[model samples]
Target: MWDTEHNNGVLIYLLVPEHAIEIVADRGLARCVAPGEWQALVSQLAVHLREGRYEEGLAQAVDAVSARQAAHFPRRGAGTAYANELPDAPAVR
Candidate 1:
């Protein structure tokens, strides 16, 4: 998450064994978003996971986070393109 230039990276960690979800946001985003807001997002994702909608839950989570990120750090002008700072593949450890 620290790899991003704007320090707005977000990591949605799902602990399958315990049926838990953790939203980790970089300091830049953490400062802009409230803790309760993040918890609400987590709760929504939890409901989807409990219903066995893993793919949909993950997609929704990504969209939610992306929206928040955009609110804080908007994209450059139309002529400018930015590369993704984080990898698309999830890291399992």
Candidate 2:
């Protein structure tokens, strides 16, 4: 349900109770990124979480997602500038 400008947005749901994670990417980004790539991030998160590194895991996830996003929808200044369409803070509910 998380999507933004250029239809490029991703949401990583960390289900603490169920001890699982869900990665959701919009159609625009979905076509650009491989599912395996997303899986690897999820797996990485799990590993960090398993070691009780909640903050570190979340931080890594953000960095990883940013790298992937930069690849597909790079920042173009002035002429084709980018405006963040979604909130920077993570959604909990």
Candidate with top TM-score is 1
After superposition, which runs of candidate 1 have C-alpha atoms over 4 Å from their true positions? none
lDDT per residue as tens, model 1, 1-93: 886888889999988898789999999999999999899999999999889998998899999999999899987888677788889898998
lDDT of 2 by residue, 39-68 (tens): 999999999999999999989998998888
Q: In model 2, what lDDT does residue 26 have? A: 89
lDDT for residue 88 in candidate 1, whole number 0-100: 81
lDDT for each of the candidates? 0.91, 0.86
Give candidate 1's error at residue 51 in angstroms. Answer: 0.5
